[model samples]
Target chain A: MSGTESPAVAVRRGRPRDAARDRALLAATLAVLAESGYGGLTTAAVAARAGVSTATLYRRWSSKEALVLAASAAFAADLEQRPDTGTLEGDLRILLRDKAAGLTGESGRLMRALIGEAAHNVALAEALTAALIDPVRDRVAEAVRRAVARGEIAPLPDVDLVADLVIGPMVSRFLLTAHPSDTQDTQDARGTADRLLPFVLRAVGGQDASGDGGFA
Target chain B: MSGTESPAVAVRRGRPRDAARDRALLAATLAVLAESGYGGLTTAAVAARAGVSTATLYRRWSSKEALVLAASAAFAADLEQRPDTGTLEGDLRILLRDKAAGLTGESGRLMRALIGEAAHNVALAEALTAALIDPVRDRVAEAVRRAVARGEIAPLPDVDLVADLVIGPMVSRFLLTAHPSDTQDTQDARGTADRLLPFVLRAVGGQDASGDGGFA
Candidate 1:
């Protein structure tokens, strides 16, 4: 197979490609997206930033949307994990804190750019749903299921809507509202999550383990 | 004074610039923004589309940001009116339905584009908060006050947080989630508002006037 393989195929297959290179390329893609946004980003720019040839980029991903989708997916994958912290509020605090921490600097910028671009690009929109929205939804559903099973909450009528309710305020604060400074953003995120917990518990018909007596 | 007036000054002062002309120009700005996104919108293009001179546009608004701010404020103004429908659920339903209806075609596209642009532009971000976010917040606050006065809900600890909780899901659905067809979008909007009412009432400690028994 190596004897007649094309140079591009040989480079891809024969080279002992490490995970670091993939990480570098994806990071470069995210950086470019943050700096230039989706419309301004180019595969060439990403390749140049990553110190790789365009052929290397093409070998890994088919198009700009694919490259961005991969970057977004990797970023999202890091942010979502089902947490069982003994209580629903504890679980939510951990998850939301981690999510807020992750949604800073490059990751936040990449998300904003992708969301902006997705509005006009059908392929990007579908890719975003798969890469970003769906995973978060799954994670929230699992968390909700655990809470329900533990008798913390009644069965939710719509887990997806619950996910939206859980995530929406943060999204609104970060994306739709004015951009806060990084320090303020982090502080605000934590505070918002704390303030939001009771409402979320009530909304889900869950026991408020915080002992605040529900929405008092 | 009339004889010595500069041509520009005279044009500004003497021309019968009716509300219709202002509406036409703003409408033109929104149309261009919808079609081309914010990055692609130009004052020249708006003027051309509105069949007016660039000077006419410049005379009305100092810059592109000002022009867009005016257009966005006008658009938002039309969407936000405090509804007193006797119950919190009725008020929210009317508000959300009207908002969803307005967020179609040119308005939706313009919002997406503005959101995309505001990510990078500080002025646009500030303008967006003022034009879009503030009015909605005020309206939500008023509605919450009415609900409290009616003994429909407890006094919310944080009205702003309540506003975020109320609006976040819809914002997430329309802006961050995948786009549905227009018909499906309207139907989904209505369904979401319906489904969300119970949770919202529960969250706010409001009596569930819908008789759904609060998350059953």
Candidate 2:
């Protein structure tokens, strides 16, 4: 997801880092992010929660921002598990469901807190988007691309629009509306896709672009 | 704009409100919003900035929140001005350009602040979305709808997706990106649209959805 791979991140050879401790620190960081927000999260509290020395915490992450980024990276890795339902629509249905589930979890709260951070902290926001939003988006786009290749559906009118259509309203439903996380997710995703289908069909105008079956 | 009108708006009997004073007050309100954020804006400062009295401001808007809503209303009104460029792609180009321009202005900054407010303040966010985002979206949707009616585009796969595709990246660009204002708007909007065109065209699935037109 780092658009540019700047080679392997080489750390100076030293005593082996504690992988378990690192994981614990990330959990504490995420907990703090949800409870206190980025501004309020304290390194001492994170260290206390992770059961590591404050110096150790600082040694691992230079600042609270770095700590948050580390926490976010861990969340990003966990969030990577998308449901592969085979069909583009099927895979999306499952993937979006999983995403909505994640949104209301610790990750969702961290994401909300991180969004607030974006207003003032450039690097943090960029890290959050790159580490979080873009990777999943690419996967969705690839699934749609495959659908087109298989003639399962028409080519998209505008794939970017299609992706946005797929991604946008789910966000709007969550961020803008007061829809409960679990209760309204199904309707939100379906409704958004239903709305997007017509536009997608139009953007792919060609012999194969015409509707093949009754739209779901 | 009122998908469903509020019951709270009291009966009104007015000769004519001062157009000049109202305009001045709105302008002052926007200034206050930008300087101190939505939370920092106040009736007193808005009045003083407009060279009016707090009583005069209260006569028009009951509270700070109400005043902000009124300010947002003015921006929303401008958002409804439809651009009929005879084709869907062409109209989108204009709408997206204006959306970029709108974001470049005070309204955009104010919007970011208010959307942040929405995250914390439920009622205000609902009002902002209803008063602002939804209306503009409906108009744009209508424009896309008209394009479909004219055979200039194919059927909308999901109208909501069409809207999202049209607005999502723009929203992502504005809210997520760290850029100051819409400096890279033209390139961003055009580039995003260009990339998504293939998928979007396929989604539309039209004979002539292979677009060959301009928004103008």
Candidate 3:
């Protein structure tokens, strides 16, 4: 319910899949994704890049979509899906920082391709919706709900939109602008989350959800 | 220099170019953009749709890129590009509302294609940059700067990023999700703009830029 990664049961009684080769395959996905881009990703290229056979790759994933989906899911391992520091502000800052760290080379580029390609490919869109996007939405909503229950936010206006506003800039950066080494984007996301927290707290008005300014 | 649309120099002479036909050509461009999206858009299609010859269409627009750019320019006719409402809030609201109004049909599709294609299309991107994107960015930046001069915001941290955060959601929405209606999309954009303005103002630190519980 909390951490990311889809369920994939290992084959029931085969030669116990090679964990090392699996890592290479995932690494190969990122490699091919970075080297060529979405248009250039292919099973043969991925297998070759990973130094594994096509049959080995096929055993794990039936299609390129499935392979990319699994690899993208693996990328989430680097992300802390919902780290709760007991206070929203602290949790958010850490969350943002971790995401900033995750913005290294291939991961960001792969994310861009996934998002951009989703517009045209219905299957990828659906896969993305269930696997990545919705999970994020649900997680943000959960934090808001916790805030509401604890009487932090006023609980009046739509929580979903509030969550979008909180996280939307991050998505914007992920899609539109080139990644910045400057802390402006980081500070922006942090500040936006903190400022909006008060309004959301007021909206979901209560005694103040722990009254700990999430930013500070 | 101050507007999204730069006035082209008069070619001076030659039958004034059939007013009715010009109107029809632009209308046809919109229809084609709406129906075919970016990749499918063509001058040939526009010519056929408008009942104009290939020669006539080519005479006015040297290529497909030229036609799309011209049609994009045509879309800017109704916008007053950052009207001086004497207040930052008022100017922003108008700008946001005008952008919202653009979410429907061919204009929406064309704008999406323009940006998406900009990543790959060099000449089209340059033409669009001059004809469309830069002007809007300049006008919005100017409006924010006025807010700064008037002590409406603190002082912009990063002008371009501020521009991105301000307008980013609209672009994201246009490209990312399929909203049900233009009216709803516009309202969502206005709300996002209002919510984000305070943080932007505070970050910029202007006296008049108090957020004042705007997100509600």
Indicate which candidate wins on lDDT.
Answer: 1
Ranking by TM-score: 1, 2, 3
Chain A TM-scores in order:
0.85, 0.75, 0.71
lDDT, residue A5, candidate 3: 26
lDDT of 1 by residue, A1-216 (tens): 333558677677756663577788998988898888888999999999999888778877888888988888887776667667877777766656655555554567767777777867777878788877777777778888898899888777866787777777777767765773342466666777777778877777765765664445
The second chain of candidate 2 has a TM-score of 0.77
* B82-121 per-residue lDDT for model 1 (tens digits): 7688888887767666555555445666777887788777
DockQ, candidate 3, comes to 0.18
Q: Model 2 lDDT vs. the true structure?
A: 0.63
The TM-score obtained by model 2 is 0.71
Clashing pairs in 1: none
Task: Score each candidate by Cα lDDT.
Answer: 0.74, 0.63, 0.57
Preferred candidate (lDDT higher): 1 or 3:
1
- Which segments of candidate 2 are over 4 A away from where they belong? A1-17, A39-59, A81-106, A137-166, A178-216, B1-19, B39-48, B53-62, B83-94, B104-106, B144-160, B186-202, B206-216
Give per-residue lDDT, candidate 2, residue B7.
Answer: 24
TM-score (all chains, Cα) for each model: 0.88, 0.71, 0.68
Q: Fnat per model, in the order given?
A: 0.54, 0.37, 0.06
Per-candidate RMSD vs. true structure? 3.3, 7.8, 8.0
Top candidate, metric TM-score = 1
